[model samples]
Target chain A: MNTFVLLQVSEQVAAKSADMAAKDPHGIIITAVSVSVVFIALIILYFAYTFIGKLTSGQIKMPKIKLPSFKKKTAEVHPTPEEMAAIALALESKRSGEVYAAIGLALHQHMNEKVHDNESYVITIKRRN
Target chain B: MNTIIESLQQFWQYTGFANMTYQHLIMVLIGIAFITVAIKKDWEPLLLVPIGFGMIIGNIPITEGLNVGIYEEGSVLNILYQGVHQGWYPPLIFLGIGAMTDFSALISQPRLMLIGAAAQIGIFGAYALALQLGFNPAEAGAIGIIGGADGPTAIFLSSKLAPHLMGAIAVSAYSYMALVPVIQRPIMLLLTTRKERLIRMKPPRVVSQKEKIIFPVVGFILTAMIVPSGMALLGMLFFGNLLKESGVTKRLAETARGPLIDVVTILIGVTVGCSTQADVFLTGSSVKIFGLGLMSFIIATMCGVLFVKFMNLFCKPENKINPLIGNAGVSAVPDAARVSQNAGREFDKSNHLLMHAMAPNVAGVIGSAVAAGILLSFLG
Candidate 1:
């Protein structure tokens, strides 16, 4: 309430605020982080572009699985009721024989050599249930 | 005669005849001008027409119905803008916007989607500059909005962060959107070659109905998890796209396109525009905000173009993208696409890159929203 006290309070507030204003903070770390992130992303994208291009262009070869040869029946004979049941049991046990890719490699390789000429093949799309 | 005189005196007192200021009167007129431009000129009518009306209403020192309790404590207009201060309007506007966008163009062209994400450098880069220049984080975020490339996104972000700067930010966003061609052309040209500019892109492989249907559903799962704040925006946007692609929601899609989005846009724009009180509008800080906005937009455009050139170094000629589409990475939507096409036409009239550019243009919408979410998470 006193005049000197009021004046001193105003002076101190002004001095403190001026000092705060003069200090002038910068966002260097934030700016630098964003810029570096953007730069790194661009590099990753460039590599992806080239790496994918190489795969399509035949530069990258994916692993291939081998199929067993189908042998003809060595000795043909008449089957009993027990022989029929044993064969049925073997067929029933083949549950994991599903093809991962429906367009099997044997079919593709055979089509390339014998079925379709050299130019192109018609790929029929099957609707899935 | 005494009664009549008393009544006249009371009217004068109620009308603030003693306190009426010239600047307030000018703001009222400016509001009318804004309304006329929005209605007649169609300069972003969704927001401007409402904003213009709000400005006039707020500056008139009347309309107690808009905010009855605040007439004496502050202007009724200030009280109405409290929703903005509380960070409600921007997210709502964003929700409405997200509900109207279609992201199929982006899903069909995954490589091009990067352009949209790439253009958001304008928002964050401008933010840092504005902050270092003595503005607070909220004000800096508001100024950085000049890079959102989309008017509503810019308006929405700024209104949430710095309601005081809403007027300058809204005006700047719409003005730059109108000038998307002028701002983007030089950078698109300077960054690309004549051969590159004329590069005819292969038509995109047909996007199956199945791919289209699965795109938004899959996108929502990952993006929402990565940036939860983006859920409001990203959710509505993809949800809208789901409606379009699902082949079963014509009625809902029609409503989103017609009444729902339209109503929200008009209310949101005007409410936002009204926040630019004459006193706030006339400040030196608003002028800096405008300048910083312009700078952010320019830098974003150039950054997009330069980023493509950087990406080109590792790409083979067949897979190489046309750098001209780089500007489309900004979120101006079809407007950025038009700019890309116009610049592309300059080299070869037959070169049509607009369809390709749209991928990134729409992506820019997602990118800016994601950036806003990131900023909101850290700063707000």
Candidate 2:
């Protein structure tokens, strides 16, 4: 009984193998060829890129087109007495290691683009009123 | 009274509600699932949302004789599907991709392109397996292209070789591409060790604008000569890059990358989704195709990771590469590159691998296109 079962199983396995081979007769060959072709194509491209990289590494240069430059107008204004006092306070604050705050305050005051009356004059007028 | 009853019966028979089938209902549900995933999980919403909605429209049953569906002659949907059927959309899609692509990363580190080439092992691998599984040469070739992880190239090749499998091949390619992060992470971690993952690559050398402009031109001539079958896709890709890098054609490049690509993508996605009817799409072969597609993806990622590890054996200590970027070699574009960055960040926060990863990521695009051309030459 054991021999009979083993023989039948072997026959079934052979039949299945034959059936698969019949369906795709050149399966292994096609697989090999397709794989080789992909690698070969890529290998060719790799060398092409490498060769191009060597030939054109630093050989090409684009022409520089010069553009006309336009200068913007700038006006410098004198600092008010209040501004000087603010700068002094900022510098004093720097001595206590608040350098960033001091520099920020000084730059903000100096960089303000709007024209205004001196802080001292404005304060005096308001006090009098 | 008898005439009126007959007229009512005729109307009921002609209605879409009476014509609907279980397959139609199943396909519509699948479409709804696609939309839900796009909205909730945010996976490739740009492509998925349109494709999902188109699937719903495709599954709606109409009268047998009416020219209304994508398969029907002279139908509106059929007109839109011509781009996919005639293999016109992929090349135009390549044009948009080219205009927006910056090849500096690949040019600066050209050797990384080999990892992209090596990743294509999955294509050939899957091709062989498909053949053994009883697919004919043409169908096997189309199925194998799904391994490239490039939707346009896959569509182009399948449309030429096995037009019947185009829908299944395309849907599988795009779906796997969208799942790059989910699919590639574990394989990346498995192949790479902690030490290998920690390896930091040298920053890419700054490529000049002149080199950039010449690259597309030189690449066009060389690659076109190698595989003439790939000219439509490769030629448009190079032309688009030239438009962008030439600096004088900013308007053309802008239009190609922006509106032109958007329109083509919409058409490609919608048509691909609409092509998947229940009777045609849900076949035994489709199940096998999906299985092969997943295997191809995993094998491609594995090959890339292993190839990098193999390359490290010869390189000097200073020139060592991180294996994390190897996953980018499968050519899903920025998504695969972004996955590399995310994986790297998991190990070392300071490591920025996006630029490094882009080299292989873009190279994979070229690699897949070349592989497609070769398959076409052999099988088509």
Candidate 3:
């Protein structure tokens, strides 16, 4: 249950200059800087120890997986079975007299349409000024 | 002409300047010395210089021995000294200090508020010392708060409870701030071992911007819950932080740090300095008061180091604090942090403990102030 609150503020530092006004009341000042040096040394020690322990314990790598590759079709074209069958059927029906004549005429008219599924053989012209 | 000159001569005689004592001259010189330090050494020059100059002005013989001597209440210094008399100077000074201070450091480390709280040991310890030496409770309280290591707090409380002692208290507070490095070092060493001293702490894990912003807000509530009287001191501190962090009050924040604080510092320094005429300042009591303040500072530092040791027994891995930062737990701001950084670098160049030290360094400020506020509330 944290509630938000508004605040106004300030800061004060100068307090006891009179007593602290000495130029080293006790010689050999053990300053804050000196303390920090010791602390840093300790942190390095800890890190070094952790690193050494890990080195002693293990090594690292990733697991392997294998799969096959598919080849490309460079230079090849083949007709569909249905299209070849349709051509054969048209030729067979053309065996007799009138039927053969009619079949030959139909084949001549729809030869491209017999193999193609989606497009038509048509032409258009555009005129420009 | 001849008649007017004769009248002036008689007026000078009556004003009591012709009867001045050697003690008065000594006070003037003392004032000059303070002025010199402020001007030349830059040792808290702003306040010390004015205070010293005020001493010189107030102690100078204002009358030429004519009209009734202006002793007791009629002196010009007496008029200027009224500001100190009314207990107004300290709070105004606090306003200025409040404005100048950056509370973000304290905000980042909420637990550091305790160390700041711990350093106030000087205030109470000094008070008890003064009481043992026979100062009245109010005056002793003033002296004790002197150990909070803050001048304004000392002045504010002294002005309210011990006006006569205001000069001593203010002078002690400001003077001691300059001496913190010297005074604190010995205590830091004596309390902790070299083996203990060399221990390094990890840098604080990332403290988020949101946490920094929320810190003072949370702190105000925490301190207020404990001591309601600390509201003014605590409230003003957090409020200033709110202005800085809220990102909406750019103008107000600028004013607080800039002009608003500067003017008050000048006035407060001179006014407090003026209050100490040689007649009042050069006494056995002032010497004794200074002694008590020094001892109080050492005690505060010792308590801080000891707290580190006390906590080490329970500290878990990765959470262990560098005890050296304990020294920074006193109220000296960047100076204390610098000391911690310098000390850490001594044993290992890679050591950088200042950022961590700041948590408690700034906390010491709040701790001292809260201690003062609590005293001011209960005793005043």
Candidate 4:
């Protein structure tokens, strides 16, 4: 080989070796930086979550307030005693086959008499399933 | 009669038994052992059963260069194996894991995330050790990740940086993860005092739906920004979590967590197992990888336990952490968490640390993924 060509080849090889050497430093630095990043990021998230939990709990107490008491008008509509008895009678008739007819009869009897006595009735249905 | 005998001999020569070697017989026995452990011990049966059967199939010793092995160019096994070789299955597994994971535990107690970070000491420790033992930087990184005890992450990083070591690394990662109870229990018992083991963590606070939904978004943004190479693994993970938490994507979430994950797990386990041919797997390097893997796993477990003990020094009495749950920081998921709870129960039957352990366990998934990303970006 000629002297000039040998010098050129050696220079190229040295440059390549230097480049490879540079990458090792970079790799070590990256490893350290990466580990640090993971720790830093997680620690930051830890604090953020703590702050968020505290904020979202909404624990700030509100001051007590005093208000003037005022009497207000209320609705006066109430079921009459007869109507109440009819309602009870209708509900009691729900289990029988003639429930509609019984309900009609109860309503008619309550309308016919201005005052009605309280009565309770029980009925049961059997299922065949 | 002579011609008939010759033809019969020719036919027999083509059979798998004709080509079988002692290595194949040994691998078959190992495969059976895996299956026995899966069935008898009930340790990671979902993974071990498939992988074990695949190992048997892989070791059947067919005629050479017949295009039938997993390494063949056009075989069906090779095609299925691409999901692993090309790094597809791991991210999909992560997606399913995300859909199934409840970040509520980690969110409720963020300090536990530090334990997850602490567990990553195993990765670096193993990496440095592997380098000293003569692996190149890329192969060392892949071996180190087995210490993370996250099989998918190990497979993902290996597929990128050290494809030749993928089989050993994957097998080692899964084996250690499956043996989390055996490996972690002793270290956990030795590291923690009885009082530390018995410390019952306060109940985790209830996380709101809004926080659950926002977590994936914020977490993805933060972690991905730091390590872009992890986007496939970490992105799918967060996306799967978003599906579950979005409330409107119930069907997608169900599919991701159910059929999708099941399918990916089978593909990953079987393909990884099939990659473990006797010739490729019985190398000196494979033995070293396995050794480093066990060491990394033990170191990671110890790091987590020690970290908790260290943290306890500054903790108030009421807020002191139980070192038992620290094993979960190695990222074996519910298995490690279960071990932590079992260890805690042994110390105090009344103590239940499963929920608390879950926080670090799931956090370890993200931690390992981040570490994998860093290694990939640097070494890849």
Give the number of the best model, judged by lDDT: 4
Give lDDT tens digits, candidate 1, residues A1-129: 221221122333334334433443454554555444433433343344334444444578877876554332323446889999997996677455455244366677775676645653435577999
Q: Judging by TM-score against the true structure, name the best candidate.
A: 4
How do the residues B187-274 of candidate 4 rate in per-residue lDDT, one tens digit apiece? 9999877777778889999998988888898888888987888899899999999999999788789999999999999998888888
Model 4 chain B: which ten-residue window has the lowest total lDDT?
B131-140
- Give DockQ for candidates 1 onward, in order: 0.05, 0.11, 0.01, 0.11
lDDT of each: 0.66, 0.83, 0.61, 0.84
Cα lDDT of model 3 by residue, A1-129, tens digit: 000100001112112222222432221121232223222322332343233333333332334565433222313445689999997887776366887778677887675456445553334455686
Predicted candidate 3 versus true structure: per-residue lDDT over B1-380, tens digit per residue: 99999999877775536846787788778888887876787677766887787676556654433222112354554444455665454554444445455654444334444555455565666666776676655556677776666766677677666665677778888887766767777677777777777777755444445644555566567666655666666677666666666666666767766676676676677666766766666788788888888877777777677777777788785566666778777766667777778777776788788887887776666666666665555445
Q: Write the per-residue lDDT of candidate 2 for residues B214-296, one digit (tens) a residue.
A: 77887777777878888998899999999999997887899999999999999999988998877677788888999999999
Residues B44-108 of candidate 1: C-alpha lDDT, one tens digit per residue: 56656777777775565542333332222344544555555444555555444544665545555
Which residue runs does candidate 2 get wrong by more than 4 Å? A1-37, A48-129, B1-5
Question: Candidate 3: how large is its RMSD?
Answer: 20.5
lDDT of 4 at A12: 35
N/CA/C clash count, model 4: 0
Q: How high is each candidate's interface RMSD, in Å?
A: 10.9, 13.3, 17.0, 9.9
User: Model 3 chain B — which ten-residue stretch has the worst lDDT?
Assistant: B63-72
Worst 10 residues of 1 chain B by lDDT: B63-72
